[model samples]
Target: MYSLTLEQDNRATVSAAIHSDRLVVACLCAAWCGTCGSYRTSFETLASKHPDMVFLWVDIEDHADIVGDLDVDNFPTLLIQRHDTVAFFGTMLPDPAVADRMIQSIAELPDAELQRQAQSTAERRTWQSECNLRQLLNAPG
Candidate 1:
């Protein structure tokens, strides 16, 4: 499946999937970004290749509440997570190959390893506290 844009229906899909064993790969971008526009096809193709993963296109401007105060200096920031463990979260180059590789590598890691790496780095620990999609998307109103 292609990367689903955030909407009411898709939000439910993501909400349920995040708690499952599936890997969640989200690209945080804005509609006005040229790079993001060009990169959309590549991102979808990557998603098609990995059907087991849940890929999302989150427009920060449109979904600011879900995004909250997350730091997004660049156009295409990536947030890769499985359950409560945020495997990766940061700005990425617009290249789809890089994202594909990252997803493959992270998916291969054992849950314990992911949990370790999540807290292993200061940056990653920050992701756990600040950039977690599970927490951000499911926050109480």
Candidate 2:
């Protein structure tokens, strides 16, 4: 897993990853959250286990413009996407094992099925529009 910290200076790195066609696993967190602080190490460890994916640590407060429309009501929210489709977006448990399992399951799904689920419901469709990192990164500021 290639983990990258998202900051103003590194936006280009993230942009490059978005264009790479690999799975993007982003952990949306805040600097002030204790749980997030503790989970950071685990997140990195998880990242190391999946070297093919791109893991991003995005602080909601720090990068408000990029994630402004996202309603992250809890700590350690996760946004997993492949290409332009958001496969999963929501608050996750602080457990790394759970996250690892979830990632594996989602990654195993066929592209056609993932696309079907992305637009199968209102919330899922919203993820496609709002939680897609590729679109967000490309959107005009």
Candidate 3:
């Protein structure tokens, strides 16, 4: 799979996708995170399975500006966007069972759900260092 390596500063591109029809899976990771290292292959494999979607691996610590826009308090988080809107958001590596569930759930989501999810994500953009990290965690189900 041809996964994308985007600079943390590339919100223009991410935002542009929000105005299009493609799905975007942005993985927020840190270079030093062991979990991020372990999940690379699985992430790539999953990216291959969904070729129509754009898969991005972004290093949060390095791209603080872009990370600031995402309210990402965890090391390896997955934000799923469809039709330029976030439909599902969660944080678990590429566990096959979890991935399957995420795929199945997203496949059935309506545009209204996508819109609501997207708006909530956009509104929760606070990145203070002392902010409650638990606020950003989401389960696939």
lDDT of 1 at 33: 95
TM-score of each: 0.93, 0.97, 0.67
Clash counts per candidate, in order, are 0, 2, 1
Once superposed on the true structure, which residue ranges of model 3 sit more than 4 Å away at CA?
A: 8-19, 116-141
Model 3 clashing-pair count: 1
The candidate that achieves the highest lDDT relative to the unseen native structure? 2
Q: What tens digits encode model 3's per-residue C-alpha lDDT throughout 75-108?
A: 5687765653555555664475576578657756
User: Looking at model 3, which ten-residue stretch has the lowest summed lDDT?
Assistant: 132-141
What tens digits encode model 2's per-residue C-alpha lDDT throughout 1-141? 689999999898899987787888999999999999999999999999999889999999999889988989898999999888899999999999999999998889888988998999999999988888988877888
For TM-score, candidate 1 versus 2, the one ahead is 2
What's the lDDT of the predicted structure labeled candidate 3? Answer: 0.59
Encode model 1's per-residue lDDT on 93-141: one tens digit a residue.
9988888899999999999998999999798899899988888888975
| Whole-model lDDT per candidate | 0.87, 0.92, 0.59
> TM-score rank, highest first?
2, 1, 3
Weakest ten-residue segment in model 2 by summed lDDT: 15-24
lDDT order of candidates, best first? 2, 1, 3
